[model samples]
Target: MSPARVMVVDDHPVVRDGVALLLRNEPALVVVGSAESGRAALERAAALRPDLVLLDLRLPDMLAPEVVSGLRAAVPAARVVVFTAHGDHHGVQAALDAGAHGALLKDAAVTDLVAALRRVLRGERVCDPRMVRDEDASRSAVARSGLTRREYEVLRLAAQGRTNPEIAETTGLARNTVKTYLQSALHKLGARNRVEAIGKASEAGLL
Candidate 1:
């Protein structure tokens, strides 16, 4: 098989270059590109069409989930993996909900990063072990929120930065139907807007 084409995005030159260098030495991966900002990341990703993206949560211009959503919109087929120093479950959940394929802490061993890349490429939803422990909490919160599966589906699509129309197309539902579900989800989450709903859901582990 050909090596996986990868891109690195981080505002910090040190981290970005360090990660690029690490991936460059791997025979199974190729450093296809690198970007130091969110805008650049999106532009380069669209042009380079990488198979995977190693992204930082705190970019100079955007947060993790926003960057994840932007990357997803820029390259629908490319897998985004948040490679960050932050390990908070809320942030991790937000990234995953926003269409990230996986997340890894900066402290991860090179071997672990390689393993995660391989696993995610193979279609596994990879997460650092620390983030997995919060699943039960998120499940409980989701249960308590009382969102129906359909509503949850709409919410997840919204969390990924989809508009009502986009969510309608994705779920094969009408625009009104998507709006209704989103309204109900907002009510349940006590959120005023789509952004608030996504943030609340991520914090509650509902996403």
Candidate 2:
């Protein structure tokens, strides 16, 4: 059989290069194309029609979820696997909800990544087993702190190491508004800082 065609999308040059190098070494995997932005990935996907896409969550041009949706819309048969540094349940869930075929942390071992790619190509759902269980358990937990959608977005971005200014850029919210949402979310979650707020929100299933 021909090698499985794959495309990698990431803003960081090093990451894209490294993943390409790794995949090139795999006998059954082929690096058909690689892109530095979500928009570029979409355009390339249209031409290459790769079987799989390894997408990063942090892209300068578009949010990872948006990219996932666009890829799915453009290439219905291609499997998009999320490769992100944000291993939090919120990030993972967002990727899955956006129709990603698999979600893998950026820090995962190369061997694991190879395995995940193969599994996804075989039509298997790939995600952290523990995170899968956590999602189920979190559903049973009550969200005592009633935060609005914007507040949840702010909190989730904060957990991903984004500052107020960065969050504002990502969500198109004012910096002051992002700050206000963070403060309100932290208070409702009974958290002392962004980290604590993320922990609390994750526990409450608001994340």
Candidate 3:
């Protein structure tokens, strides 16, 4: 069988280099390329056509979930393994929702990382069971938020740093209505302000 082609993506040079080194030691794996940013990773992914991608959860240019979503669309055949230092429920859920084939913590042992890659190659899902429980709780939390679907869209745009006028323009809602929706969303999310609402919503996987 041909060796599995892999691309390593992380902002930290040391982390990226370490992962590349580990993968290179495996005879069944080939380190095709490494990238330090989401943009660069997307470019390299298109060029290299790697069979697997080791993606970080945080990049300077994009969120890990956003990057995973983009890469999956950009390269449909590549298996994405999310590797990140963020072990919180929100982080894991975001990675999975973004279409990661596997989710692994950065603190995982080299053996575990290798196994995750192999399992994903074999078409198995790889993530902690805790992630499942977290997702369930998050779903319940979002349900209780009681926002309409359009309100959810508004909240997401706001989280993306859009102003009220911008959200109104994008959502085609009046500025006052947009403000009202945001305020209502904030209350339902139990947030005191825009930043907190964004944080809560993202944690609940509403973004």
Candidate 4:
């Protein structure tokens, strides 16, 4: 069987090149292409048709979820595995919800990265063990806080620096409704303002 054709998508030149070089050294994988941004990744995915994409969670042009969505739309057969330095549960969850096949931290061992990729190729969904622990802790905290899913969603958007109007547009809710949700979240979180609410929510992993 032929080696898996992989594409590395990252904004940092050193990281992108390094990952590609490492994957190239593996007999089971081949570096087919690399892109610096979400847009470029989509373009290259369309043209190169890589079997898997090693994607960064944060890119200059777009976030992980948006990029994952685009890649799925552009190449439905290609598997996406987020390779991010951040352990941000919200971002990772969003990308996974958008249909990414797996996620791994940049600090993971080279062997772990290769093994995760191979597992994904075999149709397994893998997430870093550390990330899974973090996610579980976050969910427990959120549960303890008793934040409703909508409230959590609104607060999460606020944490991302989105304005009320922007959150409304994204959630298909009226501005007034968004404000009401935010206020309720603030009250529950015992936060005096949006910034404080965001901080508190983040600490509690409600964001």
Candidate 5:
């Protein structure tokens, strides 16, 4: 059987090279390409037609969902698996919802990473055990907070110090809509203000 053709997509040069080198040592996997951003990944995927894509959750120009959607659209046959440092439910859930086949943490052992990739190739949906546990634990918190996905998204941006206008622009929502979401988040979190809301959300693992 032919080795699985894999493409590594990460913005960090060292990580991209290191992952490629590691994969090259595996007899069943071949490192066919690498990209530093989501756009580059999409462009390369169209040409390389890799059997699998090892995608990072956060890129310089796009988030996991947009990148996953683009990659799937660019190469329908390629299986995409998210490799990220972030284990948060929102990010992982977004990637999965966008059609990622698996999610693995950056701190995972190389053997585990390789095994997960192989499982994905064999048609299994894999998520890191730690992430699963965290997700499970936080599920109730998320429900209790009554924080919708969009509300979490807006709050996350606010936590990053993005102003309402900036959040509106980034989310493509009207300024009034952005304010509404923030207000709703604050109310749901029982927060007195944006700062309080961010703090509460972070503590609840919503951010």
Candidate 6:
């Protein structure tokens, strides 16, 4: 059989290059294309029609959920396997809701990542087994915060090292709108900035 055609989508050039390099040695997997953002990913998918897409959650032009949607629409034959730094949370749920086949945390060993890709290509649903569990649920912090669902989403992404423009691209909001939401979230959490807000959210089990 021909090798399984695969595409990678990530905003980070090093990540894209690394994944490509790793797959280059796999006898059954071929790197059909790679893109640096959601729109570019869609555009390339339209042409390459790869068998799988290793999708990143924080893209420069779109969120993981939206990227999943666009990839499915653009290439129905291609399955999406979310390759992200984020652990299981509302963001992962949203990606699943958007029709992703599987998810793998970025910290997984390269061998494990490769194995998960093969499993997902075989039509199995897989996610990070060592998922981050909610260790604490201090409702008091949340009660004191009064942050909305959107605010939680925004904060969660911010906690994952996403910049404001990246958050806007991922969340499909204007850059200014994302900044405003971030400010509001910070205020609600009594956080002086994004880092503090993220810490508060983690303590509240909102991450």
Of the candidates shown, which would achieve the greatest lDDT relative to the real structure? 4
Q: Which digits, one per residue and each the tens of the lDDT, describe model 3 over residues 110-155?
A: 7888887899999998984434445566556667778877777787
C-alpha lDDT (0 to 100) for residue 70 of candidate 5 = 80
User: Candidate 3: misplaced stretches above 4 Å?
Assistant: 129-150, 153-207
Model with the higher TM-score, candidate 2 or 5: 5
For 1-207, candidate 6 gives per-residue lDDT tens digits of: 898999999888898888888877888899988999988998889889899999987676555666787788788988998888867454565567578998888778778888998998999988887654443433344455698767767876676556788889999999998888889999888889766676566555564
> Which residue pairs collide in model 6, if any?
62-170, 63-170
For candidate 4, the per-residue lDDT at 34 reads: 91
Ranking by TM-score: 3, 4, 1, 5, 6, 2
Quality of model 5 by C-alpha lDDT: 0.83
Error of 2 at 82 (Å): 0.2
The total of clashing pairs for model 3 equals 0
* Model 4: CA > 4 A from native: 133-148, 151-207
lDDT of 3 at 77: 96
| lDDT score at residue 132, model 2, on the 0-100 scale | 53
Judging by lDDT, tell me the better candidate of 2 and 6.
Answer: 2
162 in model 1: Cα distance from truth in Å? 1.2
Question: For model 4, how does the per-residue alpha-carbon lDDT over 1-207 read when each residue is reduced to its tens digit?
Answer: 999989999999999889877776799999988999988998889998989999998787666666787889899999999998977656787678668999999988789889999999999999998775466777787789878888888887775556899889999999999999999999999999987876676556554
- Model 2 CA RMSD to the hidden true structure, in angstroms: 8.2
TM-score of 2: 0.66
TM-score of 3: 0.70
lDDT of 2 at 78: 96
lDDT of 1 at 168: 92
**Which of 4 and 6 is the better model by lDDT?**
4
